[model samples]
Target: MRILVAPDKFAGTLSAVEAADAIAEGWSRTDPEADVVTVPMADGGPGFIEVLHASLGGELLAVTVRGPLGDPVPAAVLKVGETAYIESAQACGLVFLPTEADGRTPRPGVAAQASTYGVGELIAAAIDAGARRVVIGLGGSGTNDAGAGMLAALGASSEPVKAMTSGPEGLAHVASVDVEPARERLAGVELVAASDVDNPLLGLRGATNVFGEQKGFVGDDAKLAADAALTTFAEAAGRKVADAKGAGAAGGLGYGILLVGGRREPGFATVAAAVGLPDLVATSDVVVTGEGKLDWQSMNGKVPVGVAGLAGSALRPCIAMAGAVQVGNRELRANGIEAAYSLVDIVGTEESFAHPARSLAAVAERVAKTWSRR
Candidate 1:
């Protein structure tokens, strides 16, 4: 039987490629004759750069750029043809910070002080290299700033950019925007924002309310920051930003991209098309996908769900194997997931983290064994 192994990164533990390898290894032990094909997937988040590089042949261009707090950091951009894939997390990712530094405990307050200047630098670099299109994967960011740092790197005035950080009532501070410098630098380039979430700029389900706490914003501060950023963006662009789809993504970076004439698309669809996922699924008899956690969010434009949908449309069964499966099996089944399996349920969490390879192999072996009887 032909099996397609396509899985998203297992968050802190394994990358999508590694997860696929582990599943393949375990399945091989059960059925040596199984024809397995592996395809690594990402949700346009932290692993976006690596996944794009692996799936689409690209050159890694390294450069020195400003980190979240204005510190110099080493970052890289992936270039393919006249297009470049840029992941914002490279410069301002939460992982860039240590749990403890200079004898002090780290806190989420650092996000407010972070910047996306480096991402802008990467975009500029791609433009200088003759790139005609720039695909920015927006997720796993570490800043709440309304892309002020990025605009700054592109020579936009900080006065108007800083207005985004002012209190909600001060949104009028952003009276005008000068895109002259940015337009000069990125003259004919098309910018595409590949975002994983569809949350708007402000509201209960918006950027700060839904994702700020994970990046460090909490209580009233989250709402305040989001509102201020959205208001400033709307005022500067002379349009409503609060209701814009994907506005809350990557701490309002989506709005910034939109302002720069960028188009927003589902993260999975972008990555999948880049990797030729539809063609792969069409030829496979069974498709297997997984993630670190499979929750309700997985149903909302995540890579695994996207893969399953593609596979189902081709009349193929899709199985999911995850570190933890939060949603009910019935819900998953209704969404084109034929079966759902978890490493946590079989191998225990401690053992899984300690030896993710072995734990994942065991999970795949169990899946193969169960399917062999069918």
Candidate 2:
């Protein structure tokens, strides 16, 4: 049997490549003769660098940039031919947010003061490197400033609301914005926001209200203030961008791009096409894909669901494995996933996080056994 192992990063434990290798290793134990193809994946989030680097064979260029909390962080840009791929997480990601001294776990309160300025610096680096087109991955951001910090770095003359703040409250004071200089800098380049989210900029289901808390916006009052601030920023930008689809992506980084004449494209589909995922699925007998968590969000154009959809289109059975699987069979079926498994169940909850690779391999072994019986 031929099995394709492709999974996104398992949050703090496993990277997509590590997860694939472990699954392949376990599957091999179950069926020594099985042919397993390993393809690491990402949903335009943290794993984007490795995924694009592996598939596109791009030049990985590193740059020192400000982190979400205004500290120094190492970030990179992938240039393939004339196009550059920038992973937002490298700069604005929560992964780079202030953490415990161990740097293994997140530290709260930093999210409230996070910024995307470093993301702009990376973009500038890409432009300086002669990229005529730039594709930015929008996911796992730590800030909720509606990309105000990013705008500031991109040459907007107005003072940035605040690079460090206790939530997005500072945006409430945004009186004006000027992106004319930014437009000049990005004169010839085509910019695109590759994102999975479609939430609007502000409202009950908008960026702040829906995703603010995850990034540490805290109270209802905070969200409301952030929303109002975004409104002010939008009006200054001279467009009613708050209601634009995908505007809420990466805490409105998508909208920020729109402000500068960039466009929004579906994240996974764009990356899949770039990596020839459909072709890979056609050659594989069975496809396996997953992520850190398999919840309702997984169905919302995330990597696993996108991979499953590709497999289904090619008439292939796709199995999904995750750190945790909160979605039910019906939902999985609706999204073209044939089977779903979780490492937490196989290795117990604690072991799942303590040693993800071990638990993952064990789960894959059991899954192989189950599939063999059929």
Q: Report the number of the highest-lDDT candidate.
A: 2
Over 62-101, each residue of candidate 1 has an lDDT whose tens digit, in order, gives 9788877667888778889988888888877776654445
Q: Write the per-residue lDDT of candidate 2 for residues 126-162, one digit (tens) a residue.
A: 9999999999998988877777777778887554544
Q: Tell me, by TM-score, which candidate is best.
A: 2
What clash pairs does model 1 have? none
Candidate 2: residue 52 Cα off by (Å) = 1.2
Candidate 2: 10-residue stretch with minimal lDDT = 158-167
